[model samples]
Target: MSVTGGRVPDHHPAHHRARGRRGGLSPVPYVATTTRILRQLAGDHRSVAMIVVVPSAIIALMFFMFQDAPRRPGVPSPFDDACLIMLGVFPLVVMFLITSITMQRERASGTLERILTTPLRRLDLLAAYGTAFSIAAAAQATLACVVSFWLLGLDTAGSPALVFVIAIINAVLGVGLGLLCSAFARTEFQAVQFMPLVIVPQLLLCGIIVPRDVLPGWLQWISDVLPASYALEALREVGAHPEMTATAVRDVAVVVGFAVLAMGLAAATLRRRTP
Candidate 1:
């Protein structure tokens, strides 16, 4: 008996071919989903401006207005410490802006629910956003470094590698903190409201304006816990005194520890918010 054209014989190759095609197409959806998230992040003007303007302005002010001040006998001069502190502060500012803007916009437009309808994993979404923000932060940090060096006549003692490494770490840490704040914030306004909480405390406690050693004993302990303190210490050690090989390595480790800790907390917070 002849089978009809529409009827497939047992073990037909077409069936298997269709299965393979579907398997291949499965990843396309996920890739597109990730790209969508990244595009959204890139298109946000407030975040873009923040990543560009804040760090650039801070570095410019540090280099031009104060580079000539005399170094105290024992302390690193304000010029030496200014860039280091800026590295720490700039990232925090960038993180706050990006996280606050993105999350708030999503909440306002009620698009977050639509995004959650896809098969895209939560961690993947977080990773894509973090990667985009990190790129912007890295670009800002680099521009700040180049402008500070060229116009302010600031010197890194030819240790360009160290400067790049420091800038990347700062950017990563900033993204992490921003993510954490976004996760906790109920709205964009709430996220922006956290700036004074994150930024002001760091300014007062991070050993920038007031040396950590000079603080009262209890206040010194508080400064020690601040992530910016470690970063400022690391930057000052590397940028100001490139000749101190052993000290630079130790300080870098301290900064890395803070970055890792902030990232870990942010990841945990994201995981909780994902479901």
Candidate 2:
């Protein structure tokens, strides 16, 4: 259509092809970014000890305290069940703490802003953070449980594999929520403060100390909306009953759904540069 052109080419084909592509979430950037984060974390021994070693040691101590408690021939003691639940809760707490601080540090250091200057999308950064921490969380869950059951002689009705899976889900939930929370913090100290605002309430309300049913109606309804409630419930069900019941499956689904929601929220709130 141009005056100097012998012929004009239609752009419809290119546009049509681009539109035909699914254009869903991409894996290339996510994988590369996750690999880099994991490599960086691997070099920090103190961080490694805090994440994987300290929790296991605490659980081992709990086992030592209850090692001689009397129990039924095939059933675990009440303390054992509590320990099993802690195996899930500890990882969730640690992952949330570590992820929030890491994200805040990156933001403070301008690393996240610099990375955004490249081809990385906000979702890519969230995914990488989630994926990398999730792997570390899984390893921690496995090691903690192995040490508890084999070395410390801890007992639970659930299969060890199921506990591991639930722990991983809880940890991922932590990671996603941590990333979302980091967006609200102006400093790393603010991120640390969130443990009380975000986690302590969940711990108290998630039936760790008391039964959710026995709480007031208002309290029960509040627990209904918190992802930790479902996670703790799932852990209790597996630890006490060791069955893949409908309730257990539903709880797991809700926990995972919250994780996805948190990650989506983080991505939505992300900015190309600091405001």
Candidate 3:
């Protein structure tokens, strides 16, 4: 029974030599699942345009509108921090729009049932969608950041790394929220309807048009609960300031909390359906 190094003999019936070949085949499912989702995304032109074009336009428009705004003495330039904040928010909008469409389209065509019958897990489905969204969102965010920096001549005092991190987290949070919305949405129309409710409140409360500290007590409390609020704050602090602080930690925690909570909700909803 013993072989070299005291290992069990491969001659055992249960230990078929062919089993070694199976290890190479295990990755097939992962590759197949990834390719299937990518192909699905590739076939949809509207989704591609939505993810790529709309967010870019929004970021460009905001940059032009605010590029010349005057900065108060002893304050960071709006061109620098404001553009980045918009970059963070832009991805959220894109993800929301796309997620709504994705779920609604599947339900409309009754393709969701067919997908569920496959070997894919609920988490896998969620993850595949998230992966596609993240790739698109990251591209938009990066392009916006670069174009804004060049056009506005904005400087983050050489803290490009910090800006990149904040932008990515913002994109991830957006995609997570999108998945959660898609899970509960009954139709594409209903999902589209959720955008204003999900996006506009963040726009007002995220300190883009108004200073957070100057808001009324209750409004400030509401802003405190928003994911965009944390992203905006964290980005401003890291981009404009000379050093990091405990405040950065708190802000990051808030952003991460939002991403985790939204993704969890989406996964739970997907798991309840018959597969």
Candidate 4:
């Protein structure tokens, strides 16, 4: 028992209650976690290359493949039509892979369990991760937009700024989905497997191979619910129009809604200890 002001207070009920209270949500843990993640990402050279270099390389290869393909009069070239979708796709895919695998590693290493033992709330941890990766996602989007427009000669009727915004949103969507999926995985290999399960169907059905409307009716219904479908639709809008259209706004809203829902579910899945 400790003495305070000549009175012993260690056994007091108020002291017991104070000790029993869980930590309140605060910005301190959130900011610290975000900073820690950003620093970790910055220090990883391979991850840096994967995030910053790989997507641009893929886009350049696409540019070369379609550079000489003929376009019918008054019709945009195939690459011109497809690359805008790709701008968002590459960021989404890359961010998703990086995030899921990284988070899974944390689970395997027991870092997440240790962090949860402290006063930090699950929302703080997840939100910090989302925010940290969103910053990286913004950087990735900016670089890809610059390379696609200036270096590779990709053309679009919409403002380059709008394309960047769509790309960033897609990347953030990936981050949210990745975090959600990671909770279901026990290993990095399992996390990688989720990509095919989650991403491939969306890619195929998101009007990448054919206009989504022409797909089988059930496939069309599935596409309607996938965020990638709307992401591509928004890209198509930006490519075909100089100003944002009502349809593009709706498409973006859908993607943002999915991102928010995924994050909330991921928070729910977070545990102080995982098997």
Global Cα RMSD, each model: 6.7, 3.7, 6.4, 3.9
lDDT of 2 by residue, 174-245 (tens): 998898888898888998899998888899999888889999999999988999999988887887776676
Candidate 2, residue 155: lDDT:
61
The clash tally of candidate 1 reads: 0
**Per-model TM against the reference:** 0.75, 0.89, 0.79, 0.91
lDDT of 1 by residue, 1-275 (tens): 13576677656886654454442224544466557766776686765676777677877776666856777796756765667567656776677667666755665576656665554445555566566666777788778777766666666553755766777776777666677677777767787788888767877887767888998999988887776777666666676665656766776677667766765676576533322
Ranking 1 against 4 by lDDT, winner: 4
lDDT of 4 at 227: 97
Candidate 4 is scored at a TM of 0.91
The TM-score of predicted model 1 comes to 0.75
The sequence of per-residue lDDT tens digits that candidate 3 reaches over residues 1-275 is 55578876677754663463343323444456657766777788787677666666666676678767887997777656656676677777777777667766776677767776655556666666677667777777677767767655657653666776677777778878877777667777887888888878988998988999999999999998988888888877877676775787799889989988988898787633322
Q: What's the ranking of the predictions by TM-score, best on top?
A: 4, 2, 3, 1
lDDT (tens digit, per residue) of candidate 4 on 123-163: 88998999999999888888888999998888899999999
Task: Name model 4 segments beyond 4 Å from true.
Answer: 1-25
Worst 10 residues of 4 by lDDT: 17-26
Which of candidates 2 and 4 is the stronger one according to lDDT? 4
Candidate 3 clash pair list: none
Off by over 4 Å in 2: 1-22, 70-75, 272-275
Clashes of 2: 0
